[model samples]
Target: MLQLSCLCGQVRIALKQRPDFVNECNCTLCSKSGAHWSYFHPSDVEIEGETSQYSRQDKDDPAASVHFCPDCGSTTHFTLTESAISRFGNVQSGVNMLLADESDLAGVELRYPDGRAWFGETDFGYVREPRIIGQKDTQP
Candidate 1:
């Protein structure tokens, strides 16, 4: 199992299996939060402790509600909103992989998705190529 905690240690998350890849998005919300997200089904993840939730006030129908540790203000995770769940069933929750130690994420692929260009209609294009965590560049 993989364990992650907030800076204040007020919030904790356990994942049954490590994620294959983590997403680094460039959307306004994600960029501001500085979150590297790993997606998983809610059943595959276990979250402990109370969290403060925030939904985007800028959108009329925000897709997800972000959760954070109130004390340290660290982003912990995000869950699909009711409207989003209704629209896209079986949606996965996102855990802030940034909370995990860098050593723990060795060999994991980091993908840069172009969220800035995504408008809720089509698949996301890559903002940049993916890279393996903790791996040295062989060509350099």
Candidate 2:
């Protein structure tokens, strides 16, 4: 199992298996929160302890309820809101992979999604090609 926890160790998440890929989005919310999202059905993850949740006030109907550790202010995960579940069904929840040690995620693929241009009605464009977490340094 892959175990992740917030800075204060208050919120914990256990994943039964490694994620195939994780999205590193550039949207305002994701960028500001510093979350690299790995998605899975809620049933696949085990969450413990408590967290405070926030939904975007700007959107008339926010799609996700973002959770964080209240004590340390660490963005932990996000679950689809009731309205979103009604619209999209119980699809998946996003766990903040940033909470995990990079070494623990060394082999996972990281995808850069162009969330900045996504308007919520269409598919997301890629900002760049995906990269393996611990691949040889390709940058000079």
Candidate 3:
């Protein structure tokens, strides 16, 4: 299973299979927080730990939503819309798989996007090398 945890070891999550989408977004809030997201179906996820969800609402779009951990103020994941894709991405939380290690995370890759002009500069460094699989850091 795929597993993730938080910095403070408070929250955790597990996925039985690989997620369908994983990429970096440069929207206003995402750029400011600098988060790399891995999207998956909520049914494919098994979660544990305490995540105090901070939600926001807007009349213009009426459905944009994101979630951040209250403990570390870290952007964990978000829901694209409440109707479906309710679980868009799964951030690595503090709950780690008991026996999972390197071999299991081999195929997970990260992507950088050039979507918005206000994202500042998108630099993910040399990731094709062997030393680091992705950003080595999940932040933008």
Candidate 4:
């Protein structure tokens, strides 16, 4: 299990298990918020605290709602809307890795998804690859 909290510690989240991978999407909202996504079943997460929500909708995809700390302005997590829930039945929970305490993230894989290209309806100009963004340093 992993414990995650916002910058001001007003919002806390308890993940049932370490995520196998995290996604770094290049979507407009994701780029601005700088979130690394880790998906959960909603039932696997325990959240405590109040958060402000911002919902975004697109024609092609289901509506997504982002939750942030009202006090610290930290992006905590996101969820699929009811319509999306009925369609996909999957929820994505993002954690601001910058706010997380020192933990072993060496095993987690980092993926870069070209949301901008795909969602923007532009030509495929980006590379689809899974890069290692976190690893242990042996020099210490």
Candidate 5:
């Protein structure tokens, strides 16, 4: 079980199961935000205590909803709104990385080079390369 919480620990999020995919993005906000990414089904995650959501509907982002904690300013997750309309229900999978223990970080899924054109020196703060986690014995 992966338990995650807000910076102040006011809002708690508990994941009963591991996410199908752990992702990393070089997008402008994501890169600058400097947070790991994990995806989970809506039913797999549980939120305790009250939290606030901040987002504005945009025609460009027709199938997205951004949810976060207002108290600690933790960007929790974003859901796919379009899938819900097709019998998927409002609850959907999203990405959240507030867990204290990142031992289970699998790896980076993809890399967007020109994400918002915020390019410069590479800063891989969220990459989960097992080789650097003391698994150097495999090196040949």
Candidate 6:
């Protein structure tokens, strides 16, 4: 199990097991929040404390809602909205890796996904390639 908390400890998240991999996206909200995301079923996580929420419309539907610590303003986690839930089902949620200890992620892989391109209506003039985050540095 891994324990995750905001900078001020106002919000805490407990994960039953370490994630095998994490996804880093360049979407508008994700880029600003700087979250390294690991997915799990909501039931697999334990959240404690009060969190403020920020929701936004995407593709004409409420797409996502971000939950953050009111005191420290650190983003703890995010969940898809009803529109997304209807499409993807309530099967997974994202946990911010920045809130987790490094030891808890010792062997996990980091994946870079082109979420910006995938979700945006226009090209957004930025193209990203999917790759393992640290694979290049470790290569011979």
Off by over 4 Å in 4: 57-62, 90-98, 120-128, 136-140
Candidate 1 residue lDDT tens string, 1-140: 99999999999999999999999999999989879999999899999999999999999999899999999999999999999899998569999999999889999999989998999799999977788999974533
lDDT (0 to 1) per candidate: 0.93, 0.94, 0.50, 0.74, 0.58, 0.80
lDDT of 5 at 110: 31
**Model 3 spans with C-alpha error above 4 angstroms:** 55-59, 62-64, 80-104, 117-140
Candidate 5 accuracy as lDDT: 0.58
Each prediction's TM-score against the native?
Answer: 0.94, 0.95, 0.58, 0.79, 0.61, 0.81
Q: 34-78, model 5: which lDDT tens digit per residue?
A: 545666667788888666653344344445556667787776666
Sort the predicted structures by TM-score, highest score first: 2, 1, 6, 4, 5, 3
Give stretches of model 2 more than 4 Å off: none
Clashes of 5: 0
Q: What range of 10 consecutive residues in model 4 has the weakest lDDT sum?
A: 131-140
Better of 1 and 4 by lDDT: 1
Ten contiguous residues minimizing lDDT sum, candidate 3: 90-99
In TM-score terms, candidate 4 sits at 0.79
Better of 5 and 6 by TM-score: 6
Which sections of candidate 1 miss by over 4 Å? 137-140
- Model 2: pairs clashing at backbone N, Cα or C within 3 Å: none
Backbone-clash count (model 3): 7
Per-residue error for 106 in candidate 2, Å, reads 1.6
Better of 4 and 6 by TM-score: 6
Q: Which candidate has the highest lDDT of all?
A: 2
> How far is 67's C-alpha from truth in model 1 (Å)?
0.3
